[model samples]
Target: MTLDPEDEKILTLARSARARNGTAEGAAVRDETGRTYVATDVNLPSLRLTAVQVAVATAVSSGAQGLEAAALVSDAEEPAQEDLAAVEDLGNAILFHAGLDGSLKGRYV
Candidate 1:
């Protein structure tokens, strides 16, 4: 799908986070206020969180009441159910899926 520049920015940020962290997944979320948050899969021994969950949590912690959009860059066929739930908790936001190479794949809402 064609993304607006703002959405494209988040997609690029998600792509870069995955590349930089060498993680299985990376995600970025844009809040209603136009603020964006990025995160990679967290698999520490004490805690495990999908990139989407982390990004959404970060936005919530930062006082974002709602999200405008989100992007996930991963090789997985689809975003995890838990990840989708995380996004839903905040509000309805289109979740753009992208490949490791940063190509647009699909979108979920």
Candidate 2:
């Protein structure tokens, strides 16, 4: 990603929103073609740095481990806070993203 200053600002806004909610982690995924894009899951952790900043830093650094290198803030299901908290102590849960293929899968980690 070119990650212009404006892009960094957008990422900063996104990060701030996520952190304030403490509800999501952000990451980018690469397909078989090596074409990569980012997805924001409301359940993952907020990146302290802007998305563009992280992307650029990782791109320039030793390289990124892809989604494995990012933090997970929430589950994909991301049930309503009231709904989940009310139940109390739900077991291990999984989140899925509905892709264009009509499949519920983990699009981002």
TM-score, per-candidate, Cα-based? 0.97, 0.24
| CA shift of 62, model 1, Å | 0.4
Best by TM-score: 1
lDDT digits (tens) for residues 1-109 of candidate 2: 2333433433344344345544344433222223333434432266344332333244334343332122222334432333222122222222222222222333222
Overall local distance difference test of candidate 1: 0.94
Clash list (residue pairs), candidate 2: 24-44, 24-45, 25-44, 25-45, 43-73, 43-74, 44-73, 44-74, 45-73
> Candidate 1, residues 21-60: lDDT per residue as tens digits?
9999999999999999999999999999999999999999
lDDT of each: 0.94, 0.33
Lowest-sum lDDT 10-residue window in model 1: 1-10
Candidate 2 Cα misplacement greater than 4 A, ranges? 26-109
